[model samples]
Target: MNAHDARGSTQLLTRLFDATPSDAELQEALKAAREEYRVLRWWKLGQPAVDAIKVKLDIPQERAGSVLTELVQLHSDKLQVTVNAFPYGLPALDGVLVDVTMERQVTG
Candidate 1:
């Protein structure tokens, strides 16, 4: 995905992918992207579905699935994904849940 930054703050995903980013840098990007996803209502708990995290991250669709898998693995304790309860709605991804239960403690 040749995605430009929605905020125009240098394309995050594309640049990060093209370079040799440190794990910390990559984690930071993922964290930012995850927050953006939540704010956009794509990461809601009971919501029907959401655009894939890769879409929000501007990750190429070709690699989006893999990237998402990586994200789940890296944040295994904090993230989880399951099928959408209402396929009539999103029919794709609605189960991309984040453990906000501990968010305040971690980021507070």
Candidate 2:
């Protein structure tokens, strides 16, 4: 995938890739992408079926887990992290991994 496709800020990065982008320019686009991610926002469903990051945020399913991890770690102040447990009740998949999600931190 092209840089823009991966970043999801296609318009901003499209021009950057056409020519060599300066350090400042690249940093600027990165900042813009981060802000967009925050602005778009994400939420959780009552059931463990589908999630906002995968369906609403339009993030690829393969990357959802890692993306959630980075978002909470880097922007903890702006986000509220939660872990929901729904036991698989099976031997093979029970010990695989945990489920984690994030939502915006509400303000008064």
Candidate 3:
């Protein structure tokens, strides 16, 4: 398998071997993680526009949009710092190694 595939498999295995949490424990963990990273926006190149990040914030749909927009605008700097740190976000995955090989050739 390629390095990318291997890394994905490793992560799957790691999660599988990890102990499962109770529903209450899971909810608490999710709440903490979400609070730390308020928004997670991902996109592929050439997409028409950014996809929406959805959350059931327990507010009316009408007000949720305005609230999220205001929060993002108010904390744009902090949000950006969180986004920038996404690449190195998971410390447990630090042991995962990747080796890529390149072939140099001349094409006419």
- What are the lDDT figures for the candidates, one per model? 0.36, 0.43, 0.32
Provide TM-scores for the models. Answer: 0.24, 0.26, 0.25
**What TM-score quantifies how close candidate 1 is to the native fold?**
0.24
- Deviation of model 1 at 69, angstroms: 0.5
User: For residues 45-104, what per-residue lDDT tens digits would candidate 1 score against the true structure?
Assistant: 222222123222334334445545554543333333332211111655433433221110
Best by lDDT: 2
Ranking by TM-score: 2, 3, 1
Structure candidate 2, residue pairs in collision = none
Cα lDDT tens digits for candidate 3, 17-87: 23344668768966864543333233222223211222323323334444444434533321221111112
Model 3: ten consecutive residues of lowest lDDT: 78-87
TM accuracy, model 3: 0.25
Query: Which residue pairs in candidate 1 collide?
Result: 1-60
lDDT (10s digit) by residue, model 2, range 54-83: 222433334445655654563354445565
